[model samples]
Target chain A: MRILVTVKHVPDLQSQRSFTGGRVTRTADDGTMNELDEHAVEAALQLVEAAGEGEVYALTVGGADAVVAVRKALQLGVQHAIHVSDDAIADSDVFGTAKVMAAAVRKVQDEAPLDLVITGMAALDGLTSMLPTALAAELDWSQATLASAVSVAGGEVTVERHLADAHETVVAPLPAVVSVTDEANKPRYPNFKLIMAARKAPVALWSLADLGVDPASVGREGARTVVVDASPAPPRENRVTVTDTGDGGTQLADFLIEKGLA
Target chain B: MTTVAVLIDHRDGEVTRPALEALTLARSLGTPVAVWLGSVPSADAVALVGDYGATEVRVVDAEMRLAGHAAAALGAALEDADVVVVISTFVTKEIVTRLAMATGAGVVVDAAGAEIVDGRVETVQTVFAATWNVRTRIHTERAIVGIRPNTTQAVPADTPGDAVIVPVTVDRPATRERVVAVEPVERGAGVPLAEAPVVVSGGRGTGGDYALVTELAELLGGAVGASRDATDEGWISHEHMVGQTGTTVTPALYVAAGISGAVHHRGGMQASGTIVCINLDPDAPIFEISDFGVVGSLFDVIPQAIARIREHRAG
Candidate 1:
């Protein structure tokens, strides 16, 4: 049961996030592993540990700051880490990113085949939820996404997906892409032993050349869509905040009734 | 005029609100063509779509709930179409992304509005957890867009059509993943959160007691909602969670009680028409976005508000 878990580096949700040149601004200190991707790391570790004889690898694609993401994964007990970085990788859309990731997975598979690729339901920064499907299509592999619970046995993986309308049990063959939701499991806190080991571990860094990807086919040049304009939406008008008094609740009722919303 | 394919989402023989909203949006771009997947559309469903400006309804029988097969079928059915529109849900985003990748079409999801400006698809959407609004353009020959619900008004056509139903047969590619079993999740009483005109939500300040929150919602004829903190603490089921990853709703009136308004929670309800909040801390971020806010304990504020509303109704 060789598994690879994909992680992303995103700005902390509490921070004042802004865009630079129509792209999300990222700084080394203000970033961490995407909150949702921790669930994917947890899923991969659980699948390998349960098998009793397998390895879990963590992979991330971004700038130098993205190394933090894979390192965070290592603190959770992943054995190997890989970071794919290049100047041309910046400003790439989901398709371009997926293409770069698929190439790196193939290179890893060449040395030793991986049976699964686990990912978060979506990267919180974008919240597009398109990467898992794009990565599956790029690798021509099966995809079972938005899984609330997952288990693997008999050369197959099954996942339970909870959608708006139904709870579905879905099955796919080996070498499949699976995305787990926050409901999948509670992510474990980093262990002191693993944290010490992860600090000294060497991470393999790869570029577009190492992954056999064209530089021009990625980055902004390869983007399918273009951002024509970006600006903050105007703030709400005439906001009112008052300290509670005896009449506070009555004031609330009067406002709602005045607006005919009650 | 260019052809626009609108994916009509239907359940229990009724067309969903977002699909109708998509049709209303589609008419602004070009001719509206309704694409119905899975269960066949009933006569009433067809009539409703036709009244909303869809002249033709194409029915395809297959397990479209799965994204892969749906993508393959859509690829074949939309060879002549120039633009595709669907509701921005988790499953539909995947389905359209696959089609967009296969056909070299640019894709956008969670868009508030999309239009064909100067022969290109341009869209406006909220970013950074709904704090900023950004506009994007699709430079590809074809485009796919996932529109959010409650963002557009459904309008009737000046002249209705027959909405002629045409059966489509396409050799959809075989998918490796298969749905083995399915169970319907039971819905709670009153209106569903997404469609409710008024929503009253609680957070950690409630201390796991939903009695007052439920009372306020019931009094306003609204649905109950819970912040991620409340849901995580088992105060409410996951179905009632409202956040970026959970349910995103745009009700007419949104009331938050005891919620500190994290960025995740704000994204779900920031676009609501009228916002009101009750929290112990006046400096909570939720107060910044609230149209009306009261700084007090929810326990005291909600019960009193409910009583006052009842008095107003009686008077």
Candidate 2:
């Protein structure tokens, strides 16, 4: 079995993000692979490890810095890495980004077919949670997004999807795609030994042309939506009251009575 | 006309309020068509389609009934549609993404609004967890989108029309996974979270005591919310949990008692129109975003607030 994992490099969402003149300003802050993408990568690595005979490939699209994200996946024991890089790929929204990724996956599969394609349910930056579905649409494959758990055996892929109100168990045939949620599994941090090994691992960098994609076919231009504005959320006002500590239950009852709610 | 497919989720025969919100949004996009899966809904449900501005309604036979994967039904219903609009629920997101994948459509999840732009559907999104706003215009042959709840106020109409019910065939792919069981937790008698104008939440300071929170919620004619810590401690059911891992609520008024205002908790409730925090420590994190801050114990503050509410109501 062959597995493909899609990873993304996003600004560390933990840090405060500011914009200047309708564009996001870069911070001198440290960043890492998206946390959700890490979960997807870890899940793919786990499945490959359990199967013991399948190959895992890391795929990412971004600037030269995205190679760092691809290497992180290699450190987790993926067999190889594919970095889709180009200046033309910048500012791609979830829709356009997924289109580029789908093209890359098709190119890779043209050489070696895959049993499964995996991605994080969403990235924290935009938190659109649309990539997996958009890619699934482009690939014309069965999809299970927000996968809480996934298992592969024989030629079938089974997934437990976490829903708004309940859990759904679904099974799609081989060559299916899944978008993993945070609840799937915690991502592993690379140890010094694995990091050293990853340095020697093969990470093929491909431009959009190498993947046979037209330069005009993707990125922000391909996106359906453009952000026109961003501003700090409105600050809330406070109107709270303090209660006496003694006899809280009775006070609570009295408070309800005073409020005319009891 | 741009065919806008509206995915409706119903209980028995009643449409969920959020679905109605989606219908209201779908109307803004193009010709709104309502799609019902599983059992055919009641006449009231059909009536609601017309009332909410749905020009057509299609019913598809679902092999795995009881609110199964909405994407599957939506995918089947998109036989002749230009765009699809599904309500953003935890379940619908999973289905819409999958269906969008199989159909080669541009998929945008959790859009706040939509409009026709340059002969295409443009959607406004709340990105970066509501930190940034974006507008997307889809020029694809087909598009799939999900919309947030309460983004649009549902305007009920009196136009009576019939749903063009269509029977869709089911193609159950042979697979090993099976639906073991379906269990429902009784949502007990209270104002629905989406409909409630106010919400009162408790956190670690409550020490697992929710009596005051409930009282304040009732006083405000709202719902009770719990911090992740309180929910994890079993002080309240997980359904009441309000934080990063919990439900995001945007009510007209939100009151926090004993909560220390963890960012995770604030992420879910920060969108509320107004926020009030009551804590012994004035420096608690909750106070930073609160419109009204009272430095005191939850025990003392909640009761007094309740009393004031009663006094105002009586007058």
Candidate 3:
């Protein structure tokens, strides 16, 4: 089996995140692989290990900082890494990004026929949860998303999706795209040897030209959506702090009663 | 006037609250048209949609499992609408994204507010794990927007709606994914977390004992939630985790017990109407966003609070 896992570098959730000129002002200094994408890498690694005769490749699309995402995947036991970066790809919306990613996936498929592609349920930064479906549409491939568990056999892929009301078992043919939720598996930590090797490993860098994508068809120019305005969230006010004073529970109950909440 | 299409989400012929919220928002943009998929809207569901300001109801007869056919059904029903609104659920997000890609329309997800400004559809998005609120506009003439629940209350327009059954044929491809089975996850609970009006959440301070939290939730007819730390410690399942990475919830009242109020946890419950925090540390960050807070041990305070509430209810 030949599998490719996609990862993304996002601004750390704990950092102070903001936007400028309607674009996210990414704090690359604090950027890291999307926490959810780790599950995708772990799933791919596990699949390869289970097959005992397959290779796992990591792919990322973003600016230079995005290579950090690929490197992180490599450290998690992926054999090969590819980073697709170009100035023209900046500020691409989900649709533009999906187009570029689909093209890059096709380029990789040319080198090695892939049997499966895996991605996180959603990218932390965008949180759209739309990329898997959009990329599948662009690639004309079947997709099973938000899977809590995944298994591949007999030229088919089956997944158990944990939804709000029900746990669904979904299935698709081989060469399908699957997105795993964080509950799928626990990501393994990179050992010292793997960490050192990942630091030294070379990652192939591809641009829009390399992927046969038009510069005008990507980036801000190719974006289907535009941000008209952006501003800081208004500060929350009217917070009331109360001391325990040995009657905290009574006070809380009275407050709830007053508000008709209890 | 331009028409705004709102996808009506329903289960077993009951209109959902989020769908009503979406319809309310849709009315602000233009004439609200409620689009129902999978099943025909019952008379009461139609009347409810009308009460929520839907001027017309379009029903597309299809199975819920045929999700791939949804985009086409919606496209055919909403071909004339300038903007489309959908509730931000997992299935709707996929259908709306596919429709947007197919039509080359701009798509916005998790919008808290949407309106027509200067002849363009402008939307407010809570991004960066709800740390920043950015207002965006779609350049394209047609746009798709997914609105989160509880962004606004569903208001009645008091206008009866006209119903139409639109025939749609989905050119589904041969190699699409299929749902083989759906098993409902059972929880020891009063209500589903997403649909619960009140939620009581526990944290690391619970010390792997959710007994108190669960009891309070059940007493109040609410749902139980857990912080990531508690779930990570195996005190509860990840399904109960409320954080940026977990489920984003918006309840009428949210009670955080023994939680430190990490940004991640706040992202999930910040949209709730009334936030109450109980913790031993006065300096804990959870107190900042809380509308009401008490500096005390949850173990000591919760039992008393529960007893008081029970007594008050009985009287």
- Per-residue alpha-carbon lDDT of candidate 1 for residues A113-213, written as tens digits (9 for 90 to 100): 99999999988888999999999999999999999999999989999998877889999999999999999999999999999999999899999999999
In order, candidate lDDTs are: 0.89, 0.72, 0.84
- Collision pairs in model 1: none
User: Mind giving the per-residue lDDT tens digits that candidate 2 earns over A165-245?
Assistant: 555676767787888876688789888888899999888889888887777767767654455556765444334444345
lDDT comparison, 2 vs 3, better candidate: 3
The number of the candidate with the highest lDDT is 1
lDDT of 3 by residue, B1-315 (tens): 868998887865888877888888888898888888866667788878888777678877755553467887888778888899998877888888888977888889888889888887889877764556788878889989998877867887766565454544545435477788988777653656766788999998888888999898888778899999998888887778887667787888899999999877888888787889899999999998888899999988888888888889899
Task: Write the number of the candidate with greater lDDT, choosing between 1 and 2.
Answer: 1
TM-score of each: 0.96, 0.82, 0.93
Question: Highest DockQ: which candidate?
Answer: 1
Model 2 lDDT on a 0 to 1 scale: 0.72
Off by over 4 Å in 1: B218-221, B310-315
Please list all clashing residue pairs in model 3, or write none if there are none. Answer: none
**Cα interface RMSD of each candidate:** 1.5, 5.1, 2.1
Q: What CAPRI class is candidate 1?
A: medium
lDDT of 2 by residue, B115-219 (tens): 777776777765544555666666667887777666677776456456656667767543323454445545646655544567889999899988888877876
Supply DockQ values for each candidate. Answer: 0.73, 0.29, 0.65
